[model samples]
Target: MVCATLALALVGCGASVPSPTPTSNRTTSPAVTSSPETTAPADAAAVFPVGEPREIATGLSAPWSIVFVGDSALVSERDSARILELPAGGGVREVGVVEAVQARGEGGLLGLAVDQDRRLYAYSTGGQGNRIQRFALTGTGGSFTLGAAETILDGLPSAGNHNGGRIAFGPDGMLYAGVGDAGSPQNAQDPGSLGGKILRMTPDGGIPSDNPDPASLVYSSGHRNVQGLGWAQDGTMYASEFGQDTWDELNVIVAGGNYGWPDAEGTAGAAGLIDPVLQWRPDEASPSGIAVVAGSVVIANLRGERLTVVPISDPSTAAASYAGEYGRIRDAVLAPDGTLWFVTNNTDGRGDAREGDDRILSVGLAG
Candidate 1:
């Protein structure tokens, strides 16, 4: 239930994996809705029987990104700046609404991308900081409309607590960002600090000529709050760090390289510092939001509610165990037809869950 003072306001005291993040869970399973107006019982549990989880959508509130676009499942709600639009058996809608946020505690309208012409991109926390918007999608088949919302980039740093939003579009189409040190940690080893970095712009934010300090748009730097940003289709990039009670990483993001955070929270000899193929123990895993699927990389653990399945490596390094447990997981997606979408931080205030209740899980990929 977060608030060990948000893990001491973003891990830094004597953490390095000494443990303390997990809280309550004997096993309860049965709470996953998409919330557009959820009707309930389409499917929320099957554990890989292949073709079950289809509760579709139902009144999401703290949903926090789910992605699909065509078959529909577009959720994102960090305090309800709203974006819910889930369809395929039920039909629930709310199309768009993430403009200029400032929604308190962990910021609002948090992360949601739908590129490849589907438009819709957002990474809110605005009111003067942390932004990235774009709507564009009128109406076609199953339904859509959101047209005006543009705003492509802002100061970034809403601070109610490490505002590292989380956006993704990689595969070299560029557009990746995970920023978070906004709560400060020497700005995560400052390299002209973009705040505990991993920001490779250009989807409209521009700053890509192979960026690596072309004036510092930073693609790497000792991170400490980067909330997951996957890319293993052979393009590399795979972050998930959030340790402070000691080690909770999952890195593999090297370009400017240097992920030691506060000098190293997971592992590193400090020669360039970059360790964590998967170290987790900040009470099971504080690792947040991520998805890779088939090649295996699906992480999500907002204070270790569990959902890790590492195994998409090469020079990715370390992490080959622990992949059972799923409750406090905060945002994850890999859907097209491959299936594996998750979202639930129990209202993000810390699980006890409420309001159309958390859910969107449709897992199954263990080949």
Candidate 2:
């Protein structure tokens, strides 16, 4: 469970956990194995109905993000600043270390993106501010190492918390990064600051010429702290944002659009500012990483401690599943096999940890 101290370390002081929603009545699947790996039964999606949640990898500490490379995945540990590889069978091993990461509160190594060429990109808190670095994955199979890294972009603001760090490649092949307000509400509306904005750039970190701002990297602004980014098949981008105290948000991002932050938290209908498609009470959601699964947007939450599945057709009618089962899911990514793989964040100096806590969980989704 998320404690008050964690709320203080994250969104604000005197913050309490949100009220629990009705738990989904579903049967848990057997834990995965190294061989063929335990899979969802024929009635898996029926018995469990929504999806069958199973444990994949365990004993992780503050795992922030995951990017797939073949049947394996590269995961980032927020506090440790190390990238660990979890192979197909099971188990995790360190593949590389990001330099100059000041892992504090929400600032540290966060978000990972892998290109077609297998090059890896990471968003981390550097000495000056948040930076994006690219690393080459050398070798093959279980014998791999992260080669020398090159800084792609830097100088984004960083604070104890609210250092928005979610990076993903758009359908247009442009790199999109989410940045927080760095605890400065003014930055949310400041066009000069990279904070509180979604930036669109080339794979090499160059500003896309087609951006809303020719010389600026800001794709969208006025975000309090955006931690999740996903794209629908139709190219519609969805973002999940943390709120101040009242409400959290799920907005459909658009170029040059502004999502009212300090000016507004949720759907305020403020002129010139775009409103979120879906809004949840602070306790009901503090959404983090998101992935589009089976035509639906799946969001992982921290304070709410659940998985929210929103149909792209009508996001306002989103449903919550696996409430309070795995504890503080920080990130979710679709695997090559069509299953949704997510990492737990209970050991991130917040929630209570179980025997082999901070695990990577999987939910089978039909194609």
| Maximum-lDDT candidate | 2
RMSD of each: 17.2, 9.8
Model 2 whole-model lDDT (C-alpha atoms)? 0.78
Each model's lDDT: 0.66, 0.78
Cα lDDT tens digits, model 2, 1-367, are: 1111111112211222232234354212111001000112232221111456788889888899999888888999999999999888877899988988999989999999988788999999999899999999997746669988899999999999899999999899999999999999999999999999999999999988999999999999999999999886656778899998887877778788888888987766456877665667767679999997545778888987877766554333356777788789898888898788888899999888888888998877642
lDDT of 1 at 139: 84
TM-scores of the candidates in the order shown: 0.33, 0.87
| lDDT (Cα, 0-100) at 327 in candidate 2 | 84
> Model 1: how far is 241 from its true place, Å?
6.9
- Residues 1-367 of candidate 1 have per-residue lDDT tens digits of 0101111112222222222222222121111111011011222211221333444554466777767777777787888788877776456678767666778888888888777887888888877888888889888635776888888788865588777788888887878888888778888886665887888888888788888877657888778788889875546667887877766766667677777788767664445565555465676667788886545666777766766555342212213122343357787787777677777667667776755567666755544
TM-score of 2: 0.87
Query: Which runs in model 1 stand beyond 4 Å of their true positions?
Result: 1-54, 57-65, 68-112, 115-141, 144-174, 177-199, 208-212, 215-218, 221-227, 230-238, 241-257, 260-265, 269-278, 281-288, 291-305, 308-367
